[model samples]
Every structure is written in structure tokens, then in C-alpha cells.
Target: MEKRNDPQLRLGEEFFNQPCLSLAKAFLGKVLVRRYADGTELRGRIVETEAYLGGEDRASHSAGGKRTERNTAMFMKPGTIYVFPIYGILLCMNVSSEGEGAAVLLRSLEPLRGQTLMRELRAARRKEGAPQLKDKDLSNGPAKLCQALNILRCFDRRDLASDPDMWMEREPDTNPAEPHDIVSAPRVGVESHGEWAEKPWRFYLRGNPCVSVVNKDAERQSGSVTDNVRSLTCAV
Candidate 1:
């Protein structure tokens, strides 16, 4: 693949209008850009994501067609931002996809720019005595990435395609990842969702150190797991 010099190619609704599972996989290698009010910019390469199917997906917040103020963004048009809180203080970000109530969770990102600002933002959220975060740990998890990027709950329902403060972009200069370079696995947490807990909805760049939690078994069975996800998509 030939590299282009353009860096302003933001991902639009069309790019995000794919099915949740496809969007999750496609997000890998894309660039996530966040701009601060102070005119600072933070960019990270999306390294990990998890797909949540629509109402039929038991593990999803919108399961059983339930809708609430918190998850309303999931029902919005593709490219809408869904920011929600976890553990009371931490926030996680997701992007609504083509499904009725489906979305893709950004699990982790590899810092690509503004590392100094990312470190400062992350450290400000931690206790004063906590040890400094390593470079790879800067955005290695959902909440961690949100913190490092300063993503707030107020960003919920915002349009990613038009949001000036935060949006996803594609780097023309970077080669797109091959299928073998990505891995599929079961999502983290939500173990009580019965069979849903075992469904392979999570995806990440294979061997990327920025990934939050790597399931070695899932990596070993990635081919079969990918097939399973494909079958599930067909069944739906």
C-alpha cells in the first residue's frame, strides 16, 4: 500500500455505518484524535476494541431493547459518541454502529502524539503517591485512554464525524493491518452474561503491547473464534 501525505482525513458516518463487529475490527490501526480547549492535540492509534451487538446481545447495555438516558447514544445514528462512567469515577467511550442498539467499545490505544499531555492527564487522575505510568500503560485500557484523552461523560451522544474536540481519523501514510495481524477474543468483565460472556466480540492488534488484557487461549484459537463471530453475525 502506498502512503499518502494527507493527515486530515477524518472518518465520517459512512466509515462508521458498518455492523458493530465489522466496525470493531476496522477500528484497529485507525487514529483517534482528541483536541483540548488549550489548543493541544492528543493522538493515539486504536489498538483494541470490543463489539456489542444490539438488543439481542445479553451483555450489552441495551440488551432486550432496553433504552436509558445513559445508553441512548447506542440507538443514535452511526458515529455518535457514547460516553459512560464505570466505578463511579472513570469513563469509557464507545461509538454507535449500524445496528439498532449496537456499538463498539474502544478498549485501548497506542499513544502516537502528545505523550507529555497524555502522561500529565493520566497522572492527575491517580493518587499522588502512585508510581509514574510507563509509556505503554498510558492508554492501555478503556478508562485509561479516556482519562489520558480527557474524554468526559458530557461527550455522550455527540457526533464523532462533526465533533471538533474528538473524532477518529485515518492515516494515509500508515499501511492498513492485515487479517492475521488482528486477534479476536471474548470481552473483558461481564462474565455473568452466561453464553454471551464466552462470545468472541473483542478484537485487538496481535502482539500489541498497548492491549489491556490479552487472552492467550483466544489468540491460539483466533481462526476458529473469527469463524464463530462470523457465524454469529450471519445468525443475527
Candidate 2:
């Protein structure tokens, strides 16, 4: 993948917060701008997010006394990236560290960068009988978001507050949508928890098409993206 022509933004402490779920909700409809030092800007509208707390949140990777080199960043300061692969696909992107060791799982994004490249990527997914892209389709699911942005495991645990290579920026022109306009749904996968899995923490913009429609579109069976988009660690 080629480096994007985006300019870099100065990340700050205010971007970091404890108990990242509230911040995740607040992040909705907000622009997460990324600018490379070269001066180009790439933007995305956050659409879906989930919260995870250390050793407490049963649904979290760090839950139930689990810890490893992979989850170490979840115990660091706020504003760190926690990226990993799942199901031999989908490079899930997470925001690590909030109040002791809580994290926000970045489930999906509405892309705003590398327009041509993003479209091409989406086109490949579409020809496979998957969802198509307009502007909003550029980045929806976690893996897709990273794909559109050229994000990788190298970004994992990087201090977003200090890293010039990658950091989130605020867009002054964000239009806040009403809470009622927000849609709440059970998270995708992770259904084995029985009742706890039904919590509505997973959120997305009600009308955004960048969101992954696996469950919603499974009946039609028209959505099929490349299971192995990219993930050096994922087995082939």
C-alpha cells in the first residue's frame, strides 16, 4: 500500500478520556481528520463503536482476567491504538486505555480519504457480490476503515496523542445528529454470551451506508467482501 498524501494533525490530551464508551458515543458524527506531515488531509465520520473495560467487561478481550502482549496497550494511557485480526479476516481497530484500562472498540467508519483508491478497493469487494460504495461506502467496518486508510498493525499501540505518523483530528464543521436519529443494535458476532450479548452499546449513524451489513444482508446473501483484505499476521 502507498502512503496517503494527508497532512498530520497535532494530537492532544483532551482527545484521551477515561471510560471510552461515552467518548465513543460523543465521537459519532464527528470528523476524525488525519493529515500527513506532507499536508494532505483524510477524514472519516465515526459510525460504530463498542466499549471494553479491563477484567470487568465480560464481552471485552481483556475481560475475565485475560492479558497478553496483545492487550498490553489497553492498560496504557488513553489515545493509543489497539489493532488486531479476527476470524482470519477483519483487522479490528480499537482505542486503548481509559480510566485504569478501558478501551473503545472502533467497529466501523464512514470514509473520507484517498477517494480514488478507496473506490477501487470497494469495487473489488462489490464485484464479489458485496455492498457498493458511493462516498459513504469507502470505510464502514473496522477492517475496511483500515483498508481505506492504509492502517496496519504498525499503528497498533502507537500513541495517537503524540504520533505524527497517525493521529485523530476534530472537524470544526461537524453536524451533530439527534440522539433519536441514532440507531442502537446488538453487536455483530460474539453471540455466545446469551443475554449479555444483547446489550445495545453498538451504535452507528442510522442512515449511513458505510456500515457493514453482514447480518442485515445475510438473508439476501449479496454481500461478500474479500475475507483476506490484508493482515500480515492472519493465516492464509
**How much is 140 displaced in model 1, in angstroms?**
0.6
lDDT of 1 by residue, 1-236 (tens): 12222336888879999999999999999999888766678899999999999899999999998999899999999999999999898999999999999999999999988898899999998899899888899999999999999898889999998887888888877887878689888999989999999998999999999999988888878767677888998999
lDDT of 1: 0.91
Evaluate candidate 2 by giving its C-alpha RMSD to the native, one decimal.
12.0
lDDT of each: 0.91, 0.66
Count of backbone collisions within predicted model 2: 7
Over 1-236, each residue of candidate 2 has an lDDT whose tens digit, in order, gives 34442334333766676466676666677555555566555667787777666676677777776778988778777888888887675577778756655787776777766577666655754557656566765776777777676677877888877776666665555556656445656676769867658766676666677766534432222112222333433765
Q: TM-scores across all candidates?
A: 0.90, 0.75
In Å, residue 218's CA in model 2 sits off its true spot by 19
